[model samples]
Target: MGCATPWCLATLVAIALALRSGYAVSGLVLVSGYYFPTARTDFWLTSAPAMPLLGDLMRYTSPPIISWAIMPKLMRTLFAPRAIPPEFKNEFPISLALRPKQLRAAAEESAFLIPAAAQLRLQYRVSGVQLGSCMERLTGSSRPTSRRLHAVLPSSLLHLVEDAGHMVTYADAAGIADAVAALAPSAPVRTA
Candidate 1:
Protein backbone atom coordinates (compact mmCIF):
# COMPACT_ATOMS: atom_id res chain seq x y z
CA MET A 1 0.00 0.00 0.00
CA GLY A 2 2.78 2.39 0.95
CA CYS A 3 4.75 1.71 -2.24
CA ALA A 4 1.68 2.27 -4.39
CA THR A 5 0.65 5.64 -2.93
CA PRO A 6 3.22 7.66 -4.86
CA TRP A 7 2.14 6.08 -8.13
CA CYS A 8 -1.53 6.79 -7.47
CA LEU A 9 -0.80 10.37 -6.43
CA ALA A 10 1.34 10.93 -9.52
CA THR A 11 -1.41 9.64 -11.79
CA LEU A 12 -3.92 12.00 -10.16
CA VAL A 13 -1.54 14.90 -10.68
CA ALA A 14 -1.07 13.92 -14.33
CA ILE A 15 -4.81 13.69 -14.84
CA ALA A 16 -5.38 17.12 -13.26
CA LEU A 17 -2.73 18.63 -15.52
CA ALA A 18 -4.23 16.95 -18.56
CA LEU A 19 -7.69 18.26 -17.76
CA ARG A 20 -6.31 21.74 -17.13
CA SER A 21 -4.50 21.60 -20.48
CA GLY A 22 -7.82 20.88 -22.22
CA TYR A 23 -7.20 17.24 -23.02
CA ALA A 24 -10.54 15.45 -22.90
CA VAL A 25 -10.85 12.63 -20.38
CA SER A 26 -13.08 9.62 -20.96
CA GLY A 27 -13.20 5.98 -19.70
CA LEU A 28 -15.13 2.76 -18.85
CA VAL A 29 -16.26 1.65 -15.34
CA LEU A 30 -15.97 -1.98 -14.31
CA VAL A 31 -16.80 -2.97 -10.74
CA SER A 32 -18.22 -5.90 -8.79
CA GLY A 33 -20.62 -3.58 -6.92
CA TYR A 34 -22.69 -0.44 -7.33
CA TYR A 35 -21.47 3.11 -6.65
CA PHE A 36 -24.09 5.32 -5.08
CA PRO A 37 -23.86 9.06 -5.71
CA THR A 38 -22.62 11.41 -2.97
CA ALA A 39 -25.62 13.74 -3.10
CA ARG A 40 -28.94 12.83 -1.56
CA THR A 41 -31.44 11.23 -3.92
CA ASP A 42 -33.99 13.93 -3.16
CA PHE A 43 -31.54 16.67 -4.05
CA TRP A 44 -30.59 14.96 -7.27
CA LEU A 45 -34.23 14.35 -8.09
CA THR A 46 -35.06 18.03 -7.64
CA SER A 47 -32.31 18.96 -10.10
CA ALA A 48 -33.04 16.10 -12.52
CA PRO A 49 -36.24 14.14 -12.17
CA ALA A 50 -34.77 11.22 -14.04
CA MET A 51 -31.99 10.57 -11.50
CA PRO A 52 -34.07 9.50 -8.51
CA LEU A 53 -36.61 7.75 -10.68
CA LEU A 54 -33.88 5.75 -12.30
CA GLY A 55 -32.38 4.77 -8.97
CA ASP A 56 -35.74 3.91 -7.47
CA LEU A 57 -36.61 1.88 -10.50
CA MET A 58 -33.29 0.12 -10.36
CA ARG A 59 -33.75 -0.66 -6.67
CA TYR A 60 -37.06 -2.32 -7.43
CA THR A 61 -35.95 -3.93 -10.69
CA SER A 62 -32.37 -4.82 -9.86
CA PRO A 63 -33.22 -7.61 -7.43
CA PRO A 64 -34.37 -9.99 -10.13
CA ILE A 65 -31.74 -8.82 -12.54
CA ILE A 66 -29.05 -9.16 -9.90
CA SER A 67 -30.24 -12.63 -8.98
CA TRP A 68 -30.32 -13.78 -12.57
CA ALA A 69 -27.72 -11.58 -14.20
CA ILE A 70 -25.33 -10.74 -11.38
CA MET A 71 -25.47 -13.46 -8.73
CA PRO A 72 -23.20 -15.99 -10.41
CA LYS A 73 -20.41 -13.47 -10.72
CA LEU A 74 -21.00 -12.12 -7.25
CA MET A 75 -20.82 -15.62 -5.84
CA ARG A 76 -17.56 -16.19 -7.64
CA THR A 77 -16.16 -12.96 -6.21
CA LEU A 78 -17.28 -13.94 -2.71
CA PHE A 79 -16.00 -17.47 -2.88
CA ALA A 80 -12.83 -17.34 -4.96
CA PRO A 81 -10.63 -16.59 -1.98
CA ARG A 82 -11.75 -19.77 -0.28
CA ALA A 83 -11.08 -21.84 -3.37
CA ILE A 84 -7.39 -21.05 -3.25
CA PRO A 85 -5.78 -24.25 -2.07
CA PRO A 86 -3.56 -24.25 1.01
CA GLU A 87 -0.68 -25.53 -1.10
CA PHE A 88 -1.10 -22.70 -3.55
CA LYS A 89 -0.97 -20.06 -0.81
CA ASN A 90 2.22 -21.64 0.45
CA GLU A 91 3.75 -21.58 -2.99
CA PHE A 92 2.63 -18.09 -3.94
CA PRO A 93 3.63 -14.93 -2.16
CA ILE A 94 0.02 -13.88 -1.78
CA SER A 95 -2.01 -14.79 1.28
CA LEU A 96 -5.76 -14.43 1.53
CA ALA A 97 -7.24 -13.54 4.91
CA LEU A 98 -10.92 -13.19 5.69
CA ARG A 99 -11.77 -10.11 7.73
CA PRO A 100 -15.53 -10.05 8.12
CA LYS A 101 -15.36 -6.67 9.82
CA GLN A 102 -13.73 -5.00 6.83
CA LEU A 103 -16.09 -6.75 4.44
CA ARG A 104 -19.04 -5.50 6.46
CA ALA A 105 -17.64 -2.01 6.43
CA ALA A 106 -17.16 -2.10 2.68
CA ALA A 107 -20.72 -3.29 2.23
CA GLU A 108 -22.13 -0.46 4.33
CA GLU A 109 -19.78 2.40 3.49
CA SER A 110 -20.31 4.29 0.25
CA ALA A 111 -16.91 5.97 0.70
CA PHE A 112 -15.08 2.65 0.29
CA LEU A 113 -16.98 1.56 -2.79
CA ILE A 114 -17.52 4.90 -4.51
CA PRO A 115 -13.88 5.66 -5.30
CA ALA A 116 -13.30 2.14 -6.63
CA ALA A 117 -16.41 2.31 -8.76
CA ALA A 118 -15.40 5.73 -10.06
CA GLN A 119 -11.96 4.41 -10.93
CA LEU A 120 -13.47 1.55 -12.90
CA ARG A 121 -15.78 3.92 -14.75
CA LEU A 122 -12.91 6.27 -15.53
CA GLN A 123 -10.75 3.43 -16.91
CA TYR A 124 -12.50 3.58 -20.27
CA ARG A 125 -11.62 7.26 -20.65
CA VAL A 126 -8.02 6.96 -19.52
CA SER A 127 -6.05 3.76 -20.03
CA GLY A 128 -5.79 1.70 -16.81
CA VAL A 129 -5.72 -1.83 -15.47
CA GLN A 130 -8.83 -4.00 -15.30
CA LEU A 131 -11.02 -3.49 -12.19
CA GLY A 132 -10.64 -7.08 -11.05
CA SER A 133 -7.02 -6.55 -10.10
CA CYS A 134 -8.02 -3.77 -7.75
CA MET A 135 -10.81 -5.84 -6.21
CA GLU A 136 -8.59 -8.86 -5.75
CA ARG A 137 -6.15 -6.73 -3.76
CA LEU A 138 -8.88 -5.19 -1.69
CA THR A 139 -10.64 -8.44 -0.92
CA GLY A 140 -7.63 -10.71 -0.85
CA SER A 141 -9.17 -12.92 -3.49
CA SER A 142 -9.45 -13.25 -7.25
CA ARG A 143 -12.96 -12.07 -7.98
CA PRO A 144 -15.06 -12.81 -11.04
CA THR A 145 -15.35 -9.06 -11.56
CA SER A 146 -11.61 -8.96 -12.11
CA ARG A 147 -11.83 -11.64 -14.78
CA ARG A 148 -14.83 -9.95 -16.35
CA LEU A 149 -13.00 -6.61 -16.36
CA HIS A 150 -10.02 -8.10 -18.20
CA ALA A 151 -12.36 -9.48 -20.83
CA VAL A 152 -14.31 -6.24 -21.06
CA LEU A 153 -11.55 -3.61 -21.03
CA PRO A 154 -10.28 -2.64 -24.47
CA SER A 155 -6.75 -3.74 -25.38
CA SER A 156 -5.47 -0.20 -25.84
CA LEU A 157 -5.75 0.61 -22.13
CA LEU A 158 -2.76 0.09 -19.85
CA HIS A 159 -2.89 -2.60 -17.10
CA LEU A 160 -1.16 -1.89 -13.83
CA VAL A 161 -0.83 -4.92 -11.54
CA GLU A 162 -0.91 -3.81 -7.91
CA ASP A 163 -0.75 -5.66 -4.57
CA ALA A 164 -4.52 -5.86 -4.23
CA GLY A 165 -6.18 -8.59 -6.28
CA HIS A 166 -8.29 -6.11 -8.26
CA MET A 167 -6.41 -2.90 -7.57
CA VAL A 168 -4.22 -1.42 -10.33
CA THR A 169 -0.89 0.15 -9.43
CA TYR A 170 1.41 2.22 -11.62
CA ALA A 171 4.65 1.24 -9.91
CA ASP A 172 6.10 -0.49 -12.92
CA ALA A 173 8.91 1.87 -13.87
CA ALA A 174 9.16 0.72 -17.48
CA GLY A 175 5.42 0.83 -17.97
CA ILE A 176 5.20 4.33 -16.51
CA ALA A 177 8.10 5.53 -18.66
CA ASP A 178 6.48 4.00 -21.72
CA ALA A 179 3.11 5.58 -20.96
CA VAL A 180 4.67 8.98 -20.37
CA ALA A 181 6.72 8.72 -23.56
CA ALA A 182 3.68 7.70 -25.56
CA LEU A 183 1.56 10.54 -24.20
CA ALA A 184 4.35 13.10 -24.46
CA PRO A 185 4.42 15.03 -27.72
CA SER A 186 7.27 14.13 -30.03
CA ALA A 187 9.84 16.83 -30.77
CA PRO A 188 9.98 18.13 -34.35
CA VAL A 189 12.93 16.65 -36.22
CA ARG A 190 15.45 19.04 -37.84
CA THR A 191 17.16 17.88 -41.02
CA ALA A 192 20.96 18.01 -40.81
Candidate 2:
Protein backbone atom coordinates (compact mmCIF):
# COMPACT_ATOMS: atom_id res chain seq x y z
CA MET A 1 0.00 0.00 0.00
CA GLY A 2 2.68 2.48 1.07
CA CYS A 3 5.15 1.51 -1.63
CA ALA A 4 2.73 1.99 -4.52
CA THR A 5 2.34 5.75 -3.99
CA PRO A 6 6.07 6.49 -3.92
CA TRP A 7 6.74 4.14 -6.83
CA CYS A 8 4.14 5.70 -9.07
CA LEU A 9 5.03 9.24 -8.00
CA ALA A 10 8.72 8.62 -8.59
CA THR A 11 8.07 6.99 -11.93
CA LEU A 12 5.69 9.70 -13.12
CA VAL A 13 7.80 12.55 -11.76
CA ALA A 14 10.97 11.07 -13.23
CA ILE A 15 9.39 10.40 -16.60
CA ALA A 16 7.81 13.81 -16.78
CA LEU A 17 10.98 15.59 -15.68
CA ALA A 18 13.06 13.45 -18.00
CA LEU A 19 10.82 14.35 -20.89
CA ARG A 20 11.15 18.03 -20.02
CA SER A 21 14.92 17.63 -19.65
CA GLY A 22 15.17 15.60 -22.88
CA TYR A 23 15.90 12.31 -21.10
CA ALA A 24 14.82 9.09 -22.79
CA VAL A 25 11.75 7.32 -21.31
CA SER A 26 11.77 3.69 -22.46
CA GLY A 27 9.11 1.02 -22.04
CA LEU A 28 6.94 3.01 -19.67
CA VAL A 29 3.52 1.64 -18.74
CA LEU A 30 1.69 3.76 -16.17
CA VAL A 31 -1.17 1.87 -14.48
CA SER A 32 -2.86 4.07 -11.88
CA GLY A 33 -5.48 2.41 -9.70
CA TYR A 34 -7.36 5.56 -8.74
CA TYR A 35 -5.59 8.85 -9.20
CA PHE A 36 -6.90 12.31 -8.30
CA PRO A 37 -5.36 14.13 -11.28
CA THR A 38 -6.13 17.67 -10.25
CA ALA A 39 -3.68 19.44 -7.94
CA ARG A 40 -6.32 21.74 -6.52
CA THR A 41 -6.52 21.32 -2.73
CA ASP A 42 -10.24 20.90 -3.11
CA PHE A 43 -9.95 17.98 -5.55
CA TRP A 44 -10.50 15.32 -2.91
CA LEU A 45 -13.06 17.36 -1.02
CA THR A 46 -15.01 18.06 -4.18
CA SER A 47 -14.80 14.43 -5.24
CA ALA A 48 -16.65 13.39 -2.08
CA PRO A 49 -19.15 16.08 -1.31
CA ALA A 50 -20.69 13.99 1.45
CA MET A 51 -17.46 14.07 3.41
CA PRO A 52 -17.67 15.89 6.73
CA LEU A 53 -16.76 19.56 7.05
CA LEU A 54 -13.51 18.50 8.68
CA GLY A 55 -12.33 16.88 5.47
CA ASP A 56 -13.04 19.99 3.47
CA LEU A 57 -11.38 22.12 6.11
CA MET A 58 -8.35 19.88 6.18
CA ARG A 59 -7.87 20.00 2.43
CA TYR A 60 -8.26 23.77 2.29
CA THR A 61 -4.67 24.23 3.42
CA SER A 62 -3.36 23.23 0.00
CA PRO A 63 -2.66 25.77 -2.72
CA PRO A 64 -5.00 26.98 -5.44
CA ILE A 65 -7.76 25.64 -3.24
CA ILE A 66 -6.72 27.55 -0.16
CA SER A 67 -9.77 29.59 -0.89
CA TRP A 68 -11.63 26.93 1.12
CA ALA A 69 -9.72 28.37 4.07
CA ILE A 70 -9.11 26.88 7.53
CA MET A 71 -10.07 27.28 11.17
CA PRO A 72 -8.10 27.28 14.41
CA LYS A 73 -9.49 23.85 15.32
CA LEU A 74 -8.61 22.62 11.87
CA MET A 75 -5.09 23.86 12.37
CA ARG A 76 -4.81 22.06 15.67
CA THR A 77 -6.23 18.89 14.16
CA LEU A 78 -3.80 19.14 11.31
CA PHE A 79 -0.79 19.27 13.60
CA ALA A 80 -2.10 16.85 16.19
CA PRO A 81 -2.26 13.09 15.59
CA ARG A 82 -4.94 11.04 17.25
CA ALA A 83 -4.33 7.42 18.23
CA ILE A 84 -5.82 4.88 15.82
CA PRO A 85 -6.26 1.21 16.48
CA PRO A 86 -4.00 -1.20 14.67
CA GLU A 87 -7.11 -2.99 13.37
CA PHE A 88 -8.12 0.08 11.41
CA LYS A 89 -5.10 -0.39 9.22
CA ASN A 90 -6.73 -3.41 7.62
CA GLU A 91 -10.01 -1.73 6.82
CA PHE A 92 -10.81 -0.02 3.53
CA PRO A 93 -11.47 3.67 2.97
CA ILE A 94 -13.23 3.77 6.31
CA SER A 95 -9.90 3.31 8.01
CA LEU A 96 -8.64 6.27 6.11
CA ALA A 97 -11.75 8.39 6.36
CA LEU A 98 -12.95 7.96 9.91
CA ARG A 99 -9.60 8.19 11.63
CA PRO A 100 -8.10 11.60 12.38
CA LYS A 101 -4.60 10.21 12.80
CA GLN A 102 -4.69 8.44 9.49
CA LEU A 103 -6.19 11.50 7.86
CA ARG A 104 -3.41 13.63 9.29
CA ALA A 105 -0.78 11.30 7.89
CA ALA A 106 -2.54 11.28 4.52
CA ALA A 107 -3.12 15.03 4.69
CA GLU A 108 0.52 15.69 5.38
CA GLU A 109 1.55 13.48 2.48
CA SER A 110 -1.01 14.85 0.07
CA ALA A 111 -0.38 18.50 1.03
CA PHE A 112 2.88 18.42 -0.89
CA LEU A 113 2.34 15.31 -2.98
CA ILE A 114 -0.85 16.37 -4.76
CA PRO A 115 0.49 19.76 -5.86
CA ALA A 116 3.65 18.18 -7.23
CA ALA A 117 1.64 15.50 -8.99
CA ALA A 118 -0.67 18.15 -10.37
CA GLN A 119 2.28 20.03 -11.79
CA LEU A 120 3.63 16.86 -13.38
CA ARG A 121 0.28 15.95 -14.86
CA LEU A 122 -0.49 19.48 -15.91
CA GLN A 123 2.93 20.03 -17.43
CA TYR A 124 3.44 16.63 -19.09
CA ARG A 125 -0.16 15.41 -19.33
CA VAL A 126 0.75 11.76 -19.85
CA SER A 127 -2.03 9.48 -20.99
CA GLY A 128 -3.18 6.67 -18.67
CA VAL A 129 -6.24 4.70 -17.53
CA GLN A 130 -9.17 5.83 -15.44
CA LEU A 131 -9.52 2.97 -12.93
CA GLY A 132 -13.18 3.72 -12.22
CA SER A 133 -14.21 2.69 -15.74
CA CYS A 134 -14.37 -0.85 -14.38
CA MET A 135 -17.30 -0.11 -12.09
CA GLU A 136 -19.04 2.39 -14.35
CA ARG A 137 -19.78 -0.25 -17.02
CA LEU A 138 -21.67 -2.45 -14.57
CA THR A 139 -25.41 -2.25 -13.84
CA GLY A 140 -25.33 -2.33 -10.01
CA SER A 141 -21.75 -1.32 -9.34
CA SER A 142 -20.58 2.15 -8.35
CA ARG A 143 -21.44 5.34 -10.18
CA PRO A 144 -19.53 6.12 -13.37
CA THR A 145 -18.39 9.59 -12.48
CA SER A 146 -14.59 9.38 -12.39
CA ARG A 147 -13.30 10.34 -15.82
CA ARG A 148 -10.46 12.42 -14.46
CA LEU A 149 -7.86 9.87 -15.52
CA HIS A 150 -8.51 10.79 -19.14
CA ALA A 151 -7.26 14.25 -18.34
CA VAL A 152 -3.79 12.94 -17.48
CA LEU A 153 -3.52 9.46 -19.03
CA PRO A 154 -3.88 8.43 -22.65
CA SER A 155 -7.11 6.72 -23.57
CA SER A 156 -5.21 3.91 -25.32
CA LEU A 157 -3.91 2.42 -22.06
CA LEU A 158 -6.97 3.26 -20.02
CA HIS A 159 -8.89 0.22 -18.75
CA LEU A 160 -11.72 -0.02 -16.24
CA VAL A 161 -12.37 -3.37 -14.60
CA GLU A 162 -16.00 -4.27 -13.89
CA ASP A 163 -17.09 -3.76 -10.24
CA ALA A 164 -13.67 -2.73 -9.08
CA GLY A 165 -14.00 -0.39 -6.09
CA HIS A 166 -11.66 2.02 -4.31
CA MET A 167 -9.96 -0.95 -2.72
CA VAL A 168 -8.86 -2.51 -5.98
CA THR A 169 -6.38 -4.71 -4.16
CA TYR A 170 -9.18 -6.70 -2.54
CA ALA A 171 -12.02 -6.00 -4.98
CA ASP A 172 -10.25 -7.08 -8.18
CA ALA A 173 -6.81 -8.34 -7.32
CA ALA A 174 -6.69 -10.72 -10.29
CA GLY A 175 -7.70 -8.02 -12.74
CA ILE A 176 -5.01 -5.67 -11.43
CA ALA A 177 -2.49 -8.48 -11.54
CA ASP A 178 -3.36 -9.21 -15.15
CA ALA A 179 -3.10 -5.56 -16.12
CA VAL A 180 0.27 -5.24 -14.42
CA ALA A 181 1.50 -8.47 -15.98
CA ALA A 182 0.48 -7.36 -19.43
CA LEU A 183 1.77 -3.82 -19.06
CA ALA A 184 4.95 -4.44 -17.07
CA PRO A 185 7.88 -6.35 -18.59
CA SER A 186 8.81 -9.72 -17.09
CA ALA A 187 12.53 -9.12 -17.37
CA PRO A 188 14.42 -8.43 -14.16
CA VAL A 189 15.99 -5.02 -13.67
CA ARG A 190 19.66 -4.63 -14.63
CA THR A 191 22.04 -3.20 -12.05
CA ALA A 192 25.37 -1.50 -12.53
Candidate 3:
Protein backbone atom coordinates (compact mmCIF):
# COMPACT_ATOMS: atom_id res chain seq x y z
CA MET A 1 0.00 0.00 0.00
CA GLY A 2 3.00 2.31 0.52
CA CYS A 3 6.63 2.75 -0.46
CA ALA A 4 8.82 0.15 1.23
CA THR A 5 11.51 2.64 2.09
CA PRO A 6 11.51 6.22 3.23
CA TRP A 7 13.27 8.58 0.79
CA CYS A 8 16.81 8.30 2.10
CA LEU A 9 17.87 11.65 0.63
CA ALA A 10 15.84 13.40 3.31
CA THR A 11 18.62 12.54 5.76
CA LEU A 12 21.05 14.66 3.78
CA VAL A 13 18.53 17.48 3.65
CA ALA A 14 18.13 17.29 7.42
CA ILE A 15 21.86 17.40 7.92
CA ALA A 16 22.18 20.41 5.64
CA LEU A 17 19.43 22.25 7.46
CA ALA A 18 20.85 21.21 10.83
CA LEU A 19 24.25 22.66 10.02
CA ARG A 20 22.91 26.19 10.14
CA SER A 21 23.09 28.07 13.39
CA GLY A 22 20.09 27.53 15.71
CA TYR A 23 18.33 25.10 13.39
CA ALA A 24 16.41 23.04 15.90
CA VAL A 25 15.58 19.44 15.13
CA SER A 26 14.52 17.09 17.86
CA GLY A 27 15.77 13.82 16.32
CA LEU A 28 17.08 12.06 13.24
CA VAL A 29 17.22 8.34 12.46
CA LEU A 30 19.72 7.72 9.67
CA VAL A 31 18.90 4.40 7.99
CA SER A 32 21.39 2.96 5.56
CA GLY A 33 22.29 6.46 4.37
CA TYR A 34 24.98 7.75 2.07
CA TYR A 35 27.45 10.40 3.07
CA PHE A 36 30.81 11.50 1.66
CA PRO A 37 29.90 10.00 -1.70
CA THR A 38 31.80 9.31 -4.89
CA ALA A 39 30.26 9.00 -8.33
CA ARG A 40 29.80 5.40 -9.40
CA THR A 41 29.52 3.56 -12.70
CA ASP A 42 25.85 3.08 -11.90
CA PHE A 43 25.57 6.86 -11.80
CA TRP A 44 26.77 7.17 -15.38
CA LEU A 45 24.72 4.19 -16.51
CA THR A 46 21.50 5.14 -14.81
CA SER A 47 21.94 8.74 -15.83
CA ALA A 48 21.24 7.85 -19.45
CA PRO A 49 17.57 8.47 -18.84
CA ALA A 50 18.46 12.00 -17.78
CA MET A 51 20.70 12.98 -20.66
CA PRO A 52 19.31 15.17 -23.48
CA LEU A 53 19.28 13.08 -26.63
CA LEU A 54 19.66 9.90 -24.65
CA GLY A 55 16.77 10.81 -22.38
CA ASP A 56 14.46 11.04 -25.35
CA LEU A 57 15.93 7.91 -26.85
CA MET A 58 15.57 6.04 -23.59
CA ARG A 59 12.00 7.02 -22.84
CA TYR A 60 10.79 6.22 -26.34
CA THR A 61 12.71 3.00 -26.60
CA SER A 62 10.89 -0.18 -25.81
CA PRO A 63 12.36 -2.97 -23.67
CA PRO A 64 15.26 -0.84 -22.42
CA ILE A 65 16.79 -4.11 -23.53
CA ILE A 66 19.69 -4.00 -21.15
CA SER A 67 17.95 -2.93 -17.94
CA TRP A 68 15.02 -5.18 -18.67
CA ALA A 69 17.39 -8.11 -18.45
CA ILE A 70 19.53 -6.90 -15.58
CA MET A 71 17.04 -5.11 -13.32
CA PRO A 72 16.04 -8.23 -11.44
CA LYS A 73 19.62 -9.08 -10.67
CA LEU A 74 20.27 -5.51 -9.58
CA MET A 75 17.19 -5.54 -7.37
CA ARG A 76 18.22 -8.84 -5.85
CA THR A 77 21.71 -7.54 -5.24
CA LEU A 78 20.26 -4.45 -3.56
CA PHE A 79 18.55 -6.71 -1.08
CA ALA A 80 21.24 -9.33 -0.84
CA PRO A 81 21.52 -11.51 2.30
CA ARG A 82 17.71 -11.36 2.22
CA ALA A 83 15.17 -11.99 -0.47
CA ILE A 84 13.15 -9.13 -1.93
CA PRO A 85 9.69 -9.28 -0.39
CA PRO A 86 6.91 -10.55 -2.64
CA GLU A 87 5.00 -7.34 -2.08
CA PHE A 88 8.00 -5.29 -3.10
CA LYS A 89 8.65 -7.37 -6.18
CA ASN A 90 4.98 -7.30 -7.16
CA GLU A 91 3.98 -3.84 -6.05
CA PHE A 92 7.07 -1.78 -6.58
CA PRO A 93 6.63 0.33 -9.71
CA ILE A 94 10.02 -0.10 -11.27
CA SER A 95 8.77 2.02 -14.12
CA LEU A 96 8.47 4.95 -11.77
CA ALA A 97 12.11 4.65 -10.85
CA LEU A 98 13.02 4.28 -14.52
CA ARG A 99 10.92 7.10 -15.86
CA PRO A 100 12.89 9.93 -17.44
CA LYS A 101 11.65 12.58 -15.03
CA GLN A 102 12.39 10.49 -11.98
CA LEU A 103 15.77 9.48 -13.33
CA ARG A 104 16.59 13.14 -13.91
CA ALA A 105 15.74 14.00 -10.34
CA ALA A 106 17.79 11.13 -8.98
CA ALA A 107 20.72 12.16 -11.13
CA GLU A 108 20.41 15.73 -9.94
CA GLU A 109 20.41 14.61 -6.35
CA SER A 110 23.37 12.33 -6.86
CA ALA A 111 25.25 15.13 -8.55
CA PHE A 112 24.45 17.51 -5.74
CA LEU A 113 25.46 15.13 -2.98
CA ILE A 114 29.18 15.58 -3.30
CA PRO A 115 29.05 19.35 -3.16
CA ALA A 116 26.65 19.24 -0.24
CA ALA A 117 29.02 16.99 1.68
CA ALA A 118 32.07 19.03 0.82
CA GLN A 119 30.37 22.23 1.94
CA LEU A 120 29.05 20.70 5.13
CA ARG A 121 32.15 18.76 5.99
CA LEU A 122 33.70 19.33 9.45
CA GLN A 123 31.07 21.94 10.36
CA TYR A 124 30.23 21.76 14.07
CA ARG A 125 27.12 22.72 15.87
CA VAL A 126 26.19 23.35 19.47
CA SER A 127 22.96 21.47 18.77
CA GLY A 128 22.83 17.94 20.13
CA VAL A 129 19.79 16.41 18.52
CA GLN A 130 19.57 12.66 18.82
CA LEU A 131 21.07 10.82 15.83
CA GLY A 132 21.30 7.12 15.13
CA SER A 133 22.31 4.81 12.28
CA CYS A 134 20.40 1.68 11.33
CA MET A 135 21.55 -1.10 9.04
CA GLU A 136 21.57 -4.85 8.69
CA ARG A 137 24.90 -6.44 9.49
CA LEU A 138 26.01 -7.68 6.10
CA THR A 139 29.24 -8.01 4.16
CA GLY A 140 28.31 -5.37 1.63
CA SER A 141 26.01 -2.41 1.30
CA SER A 142 25.59 1.00 -0.40
CA ARG A 143 25.68 2.83 2.90
CA PRO A 144 28.49 5.19 3.87
CA THR A 145 31.48 3.63 5.51
CA SER A 146 31.25 3.58 9.30
CA ARG A 147 34.33 5.75 9.67
CA ARG A 148 32.88 8.35 7.30
CA LEU A 149 29.47 8.01 8.89
CA HIS A 150 30.93 8.63 12.32
CA ALA A 151 32.71 11.68 10.99
CA VAL A 152 29.38 13.00 9.73
CA LEU A 153 27.25 11.95 12.65
CA PRO A 154 29.71 11.85 15.47
CA SER A 155 27.05 11.24 18.11
CA SER A 156 25.09 8.57 16.29
CA LEU A 157 24.27 5.34 18.04
CA LEU A 158 24.53 2.23 15.89
CA HIS A 159 21.76 -0.35 15.67
CA LEU A 160 22.88 -3.24 13.51
CA VAL A 161 20.44 -5.93 12.48
CA GLU A 162 21.80 -9.44 12.00
CA ASP A 163 21.65 -11.26 8.68
CA ALA A 164 20.57 -8.34 6.61
CA GLY A 165 22.07 -5.74 4.31
CA HIS A 166 21.15 -2.23 3.22
CA MET A 167 17.65 -3.44 2.69
CA VAL A 168 17.30 -3.60 6.44
CA THR A 169 14.18 -1.48 6.10
CA TYR A 170 12.40 -4.51 4.68
CA ALA A 171 14.47 -7.10 6.52
CA ASP A 172 12.97 -6.30 9.93
CA ALA A 173 10.20 -3.75 10.19
CA ALA A 174 9.88 -4.32 13.91
CA GLY A 175 13.56 -3.68 14.49
CA ILE A 176 13.38 -0.44 12.50
CA ALA A 177 10.24 0.60 14.35
CA ASP A 178 11.99 -0.07 17.63
CA ALA A 179 14.96 2.01 16.54
CA VAL A 180 12.71 4.90 15.55
CA ALA A 181 10.79 4.56 18.79
CA ALA A 182 14.02 4.69 20.71
CA LEU A 183 14.73 7.99 18.97
CA ALA A 184 11.23 9.23 19.78
CA PRO A 185 10.98 11.69 22.58
CA SER A 186 8.94 10.81 25.67
CA ALA A 187 7.48 14.29 25.24
CA PRO A 188 6.53 16.03 22.01
CA VAL A 189 9.51 17.27 19.98
CA ARG A 190 9.91 21.02 19.55
CA THR A 191 11.91 22.81 16.88
CA ALA A 192 13.00 26.41 16.75
Query: lDDT of each prediction vs. the true structure?
Result: 0.34, 0.40, 0.60
Candidate order by TM-score, highest to lowest? 3, 2, 1
lDDT of 2 at 135: 19
lDDT against true structure, model 3:
0.60
Most accurate candidate by lDDT: 3
Per-candidate total of colliding backbone pairs = 20, 7, 0
Task: For candidate 2, list the clashing residue pairs, or say none.
Answer: 127-153, 127-154, 128-153, 128-154, 129-158, 134-160, 134-161
Better of 2 and 3 by TM-score: 3
Ranking according to lDDT, highest score first = 3, 2, 1
lDDT tens per residue, model 3, 30-64: 55555455645555554455577867677557425
Span of ten consecutive residues with least summed lDDT in model 2: 130-139
TM-score of 1: 0.27
Residue-by-residue lDDT tens digits, candidate 1, 109-136: 3222335445544543454322122122
lDDT of 2 by residue, 75-175 (tens): 23322232232443344243234344444444444455555555655544542322222211222433332345444444424455444332333344566
RMSD of each: 14.2, 10.9, 4.8
Query: Which candidate do you rate higher for lDDT, 1 or 2?
Result: 2
Residue 2 miss distance in model 3 (angstroms): 24
Off by over 4 Å in 3: 1-8, 20-23, 124-127, 134-137, 140-144, 189-192
